[model samples]
Target chain A: MKTLQNFLFELCGEQLPSGFERMSTGAKELLAPLVDECYTDRSGNIVGYRRAALANAKKVMVEAHLDEIGLMVTKIDDNGFLHFTNLAGFSPEILPATSVTVRGVRPLPGVVATLPPHLLSPEEQKKPLPMDKMVIDIGYSAARARELVRVGDPIVLRQSCADLLNHRVCGKALDNRAGVAVILNALNDLVKMPLPVNLYVVFSAGEEFNGFGARHAAWEIAPDEALVIDVTHGASAQTPKNKAFPLGGGVMIGVAPVLNGEVTACLLDLAARNQIPYGREAMSGRTGTNSDGIAVSRAGVPVGLASIPLRYMHSGCEVVDLADMQACSRLIGRYVMQGGAVHYE
Target chain B: MIDAIRELAGVSGVSGNERNISEYIKGQILPYVDKVYEDSLGNLVAVRRGEGSRVMLMAHMDQIGLVASFVDDKGFVRVAPVGHVDPKTTVGRPVVFENGETGVFICGSKEKKEPELKDCYVDIGAADRAEALRRVEIGQTASFLSNTFETGRKIVSGALDNRAGCYCLMETLRRVKNNSCELYAVFTVQEEVGLRGAKVSGFEIAPDVAIAVDVTLSGDHPDARETTAVLGGGAAVKICDRSAICSRGIIEDLENLAARRGIPVQRDVLASGGTDIGSVQLLGKGVQVGGVSIPVRYCHSAVEMADKNDIEAVIGLLTAYLEK
Candidate 1:
C-alpha cells in the first residue's frame, strides 16, 4: 500500500461509487501503523487498534464513516441512459440537471435524462419531477451499455469540490470523505502526541445506506466510548439561524442528544483548552451517524458525535471549510491524549 | 413586517387582554395615522389619508384563548375558549391568569379520552372562588400563553397567527414611504372569532384597498412539496381565497412590483379560510383587497416557524409598495 504523504487527494479507490470497498481501503492504509493492527470486516469497515495505548486507559472508539452516498445502476436503456435505484436517500428534484458517471467495465460520463420542456404536458412543468420517472443519459446504445454495466454497479455524480464565495469548497462525496480526512489526520498526529487512553480509530463504512459497516465495526471492536465525526448542515442565507453552522466556525460538537455527553464534554473541553473556536451540534434525536449504531452497540455504548458542518449535506457537491477539518483533527487528537477515562451516569 | 410579527407574538393578548396590545399599536401608530381612535370594543384604528384609492391593511391583535368562567372551592378555575382552539393543544399547556397567576391546564375528564370545554379547567394558587375573583374576573379573557425564547436564531413558538401580520404592518409604518392614496393600518381585535376588529376598523378607514397581513402555512418541511413555500421562500401574496378573490390589478401590480424590484415572493390562492380583508370588504363600500402572508410552519403550535429571510423579503416588498 502506498503511504500517502500528502493528505490532499490520495485515491481512496481508483474507481468511483464502489463505496465501502474503496473508502475502507483508504482508512486502513492510514491506520496500518498507528494501531496494534487494522483489518476490514466482511461489511468493509476498517477497524484498527492501539490496545491500552496508555495505562489503565479508557477504551475509546473514534469513528468517521468511510462510505459516500451514491446511486446503483439498476437498468441501462439502449439510448445509453441509465435507470438507477438509490443506494441512499435522495430527492429526485435535485437529481435532475446533475452530472453522473457509471462505474462498470469502463467509466462513462453522463447527464441525468430529464423530459424535454417542449414534449412535457402542461401539468408536468408546473410540478416537481417525481422519482422513478427520471433517467441518466450515458449516450450509448442499449447493447453496448448493457455489456459494460452490471445490475449492481455503483454510480457517482460529478460534483466539483472547489472553494466558493468564501473559503467554502464544493465537492461530491464529502459526507464521509470529510470524516475520512479527519480520521487520517488524527491517526498521523497520534504518534507525535501520546495519549492517556486506548484510541481505536475506526473508519466505519456503509453508513450512507443501512449502517451495515458501523454495526459490524461496533461488534468487532466494541469500545467503551465512541466518538463519531460526520457532516451536518452548514450555513447558507436560506438556513435558519438555529439549524445552521457557519463554514469558518470550528467543528460542531453534538450536545443535544445526551447519549454522548461525556465524549461531547471532552471534545468541548479540549476545544476550549486548545483555543479552538467550536460551535454546538444540536439535534433533538439520534445523530443519524455511525454513532447511532455505536450508541446501541452491545449493552448500549455511550457515544458522542462531532460534526463538520458542510453545506448541502447528502446532496452532491457538499461544501466544507478546511479550517473545520483542521480544528476537528486537533480537538479529537488532543482530547484522546489528555483523558481516556469516562464515567457516565 | 418584523415589527408586526414581533409585537403580535410577544404580547399576551389572548382575547379580552388585547387591551395592552391595542394600547401598544395605538401609541406607535397614533401620530402617523390620519385619524386614530379606539372602538367601544377596544379595537384600535389608524387612518392615513386616502385620496384617489383607499386602502385598509389589518392585523388582528387577539388570539384563541380561555376566559376564567368559574373558580372551584380548591381555587381551580373553569375557563372558556374565546376562539377556535384545538382541544388537543390546550391540554397540559401552561396558562397565565389575569393577575399573573400561572397554572397548568388539565382536563377534568382525562379518562373520557375526548375533552369538551366543560372538562378543562385552570388551577391557580388560591383557596377559593372569593380569592380567585380578586385575581381573575369572569370576563377575563386570557390569550394563548407562549413565552418567546431563542433556541437558535430567534424562535418564539406561540400565538403568531395574526400577530405576525400585526408585526408586518408595524414594520410597514416604520419603513413605508410615498403616499398617493390613504393607507389605513388597523390593529383589529376579535379577528379570530369573526374578524370583528376589521369590521369596525374597515368601516372607519373605508379605503379603496384592503390588505391583511397574517401567517400562512409553509409546507416545505421534509416530504413537503417544492411548490409548498418554505418559511424562507419569501412573502406570500394572496391572489384569491375562499373568502374573496384578490383584485386582479392589485395582484398584478404587486407581482410586477416584486419582479421589477428584486424581492422574493410567492403567489397564493388559499385553499380555504379567510383573512380580515373579508370583514374589511363587507364593512361599507367594498375595497380592492389583497394580503401579504408570512409562510410559517405549525401555525397554531408552540413551534410555529417563519423564515427570517422571508420576513425580510416581505419588509423589502412592503417598503417598495408603500414608498410610492
Candidate 2:
C-alpha cells in the first residue's frame, strides 16, 4: 500500500515547470487509476472525473496547479555557459552556488556561480550579488553547449524529495504538488464510498506563471462549486504570525471576497464536525492563487481555497507535513460526501 | 586564436564564479602541457618543465558583471555591480543568472540624476517578492546577455577583454613545442575584483619572470584619443599602467623578440586600469614582469571589439618569446 507521502513525493518529482506541463507523464500515471475517467485538457491540465451515485448530480471541482516555478535558458555563451531567466519568481539570494538541471535535449547538471567570500571586498561581502552576474556553468564549451541546449529550454533546481523527521517532506515543486496529493488522497477514499456529486479533480498547469490553467479547467468542468487546494506559507521564525500558518496546523481555509461565503462556511463546519485541524486565512481581495481565477471563470463559481501549510515555499527545499495533508484530504472527502450543498439564506 | 577568443567569451566567470571558464581552459590546455591543475582560487595553472628560469604567464578568466543584492516586495531584484561595471552600460540591457534565469536590467525612471546601482533592478517578470524568490535568490550572480559576432576584421563580444588575453596564452601554449624555460601558463580568477586570483596563484608559483597576457584600452574609437594602444596596430607591449610598471629588461626582450619575429607591435601606456600583471609583479622576493596586451576597443562594455590582426600578433609574439 502506497502512502500519501509516497504519492506526494512522486508528484513532486515530475519536473513540470510552468509552460512545460506536457512532460508530466509520471504524474498523470499516478493519477489515472484513482478516477473513473482521466484526460488532459488543451492547456495541459490533467482532468479526472468520478460519477456520482444518482442522476442529475451537482458538479464539484477540486483543483491543484501542477506547474512549478523554474528557469529557462536565454543564451548559451561561447564556453558553453548557460544564461537563463526565471520561469516564475524566486529569491535571488538562494540561487548563487546552487546546483540545477537544465532540461535540454538531455538533462545536464550545472551550478550557479557565486564569488567565494574570500574573493569579495569588505563592502561587497555585505551586499547581495546581482542576478545578471550569475550564469549556469555546465562545464561545456560553446559548440558542445549549443549541441545539448537551446534557448527556451527549461531548467529546474536539482533537488530530490525526501522524508524528514516528524512526518515532514521536503523538496522542490511541493507548493501545489502537495495540494494535488491531497486531492488524490480524497479521491482514494471517495472511490470506496459513493459520492453525492460528480467530482472533478483537475491537476492544473500554468498557475505559477498565471492562473490560466485553473481558469481553463474550471470553464471546462463548469462545476457548481469548487475547492482549490494549494500551498500557503508555513510558519517559520522568519515569517510573521499573520503572514504564515503552522506546518502541522492542518488545512488553511481561505476567507476572502473571491471565495463563496456559503462554501467557506460549510468547509469550516465540515472540518469541525470531522475533528480535522484547520486554520483560517483572511484575504482582503484576491487570494493570490487559482481560487481567484477559478472563482471568476465563465459566469462565476462558488469557490473555496483549502491550502496546506508549506515552509520555505518556492525554494528547492519546500517542506510540508503529512499529518496536515491527511487532515486536508479528510476534510475535502467529507465535503464531497455532503455534496457541497451549502444553501444561502 | 579568434576561435579560441570567441569560445572563451562564451563562458561566464564573473570574478568569483570562474569554475566554468577555468574548467574550459583546463580542457583546452591539458593535452598540450606536461602538467595542468587548478589552484585554491580556481586559477587554471599549466606547466611544462624545463632547465631555464620559470616564466609564469598570467591571464585572468573572470569578467565584469552584476550580482543580485536584494529583492523588493514587488519581485523587482536589486543588484550590486560586480568589478567595475559602469552603471551607464547596464541599463536597458538583459542579464542572465547562473541558473539560466534571465532578467531585464532597469532603473527608476523618476530619478533625474545619473543612474546608480542602488536605483537599478532586474525585472524577471515576477509578480511579487514571493514569486521572484521562487526562481532566483539574492547573492546569485548574472552576466550581460550578449553574443560573440565578427564584423569584417574585428570580433566583438562581452568578456573579450580577458578572453582575448586567455586565447593568446592558450595559442602560445599550444604552439610552444620545446621546453626551454619552465612555463607556468596560469589562467587566473577574480582579476576584475582587485586581481585577487592572481595574488594567490602568483604567490604559489613565484617565477623568475612573469608576463600578463591581457587586453589594453584601444584609442582607435572616435570618443577616445588619450589611450596609447590602437586596434590593428598589432600587440601592445606594456610599458606602464596605474597598477604596475613593466620591467625594463622584459620590455626590451619583448620588443626584440617581436622585431626578430617580424610581428607588428605597439607600445601600451594606460593612465588607469590594471590586469593580472599588477598582482603577479608583487609576488615573491621580487619578480620582473611585463605584459602582451591585445589592443581592444571599448574595454569594459559589451560589444568590445578586438582586431584579428592584433590577436594574431599577440599569439605570435608570445610563441616566439616562449620558444626562445
Q: Retained native contacts per candidate, as fractions?
A: 0.00, 0.00
TM-score of model 1 relative to the true fold? 0.49
Tens digit per residue, CA lDDT, model 2, B169-235: 8888888878579999999888898989888888799788889999988876786744557889899
Task: Write the residue-wise lDDT of candidate 1 on A147-260 in tens digits.
Answer: 887554667777655557755566777776777777777777776656667777767655665465666566656777778888888998799988888998999988866466
Task: For each candidate, give the interface RMSD after superposing the true interface residues on Cα.
Answer: 26.6, 27.8
Query: What's the lDDT for residue B81 in model 2?
Result: 86
TM-score of chain A of each: 0.89, 0.97
Q: After superposition, how far is residue A293 of candidate 2 from its true place, in Å?
A: 0.7
Docking class of 1: incorrect
> Per-residue CA lDDT of candidate 1, range B131-200, in tens?
8777787777665577655444434568767676676677777776565667767787888787777777
Please give the lDDT score at residue A55 for candidate 1. Answer: 69
Q: Write the per-residue lDDT of candidate 2 for residues A56-89, one digit (tens) a residue.
A: 8899998899888877675677778887656565
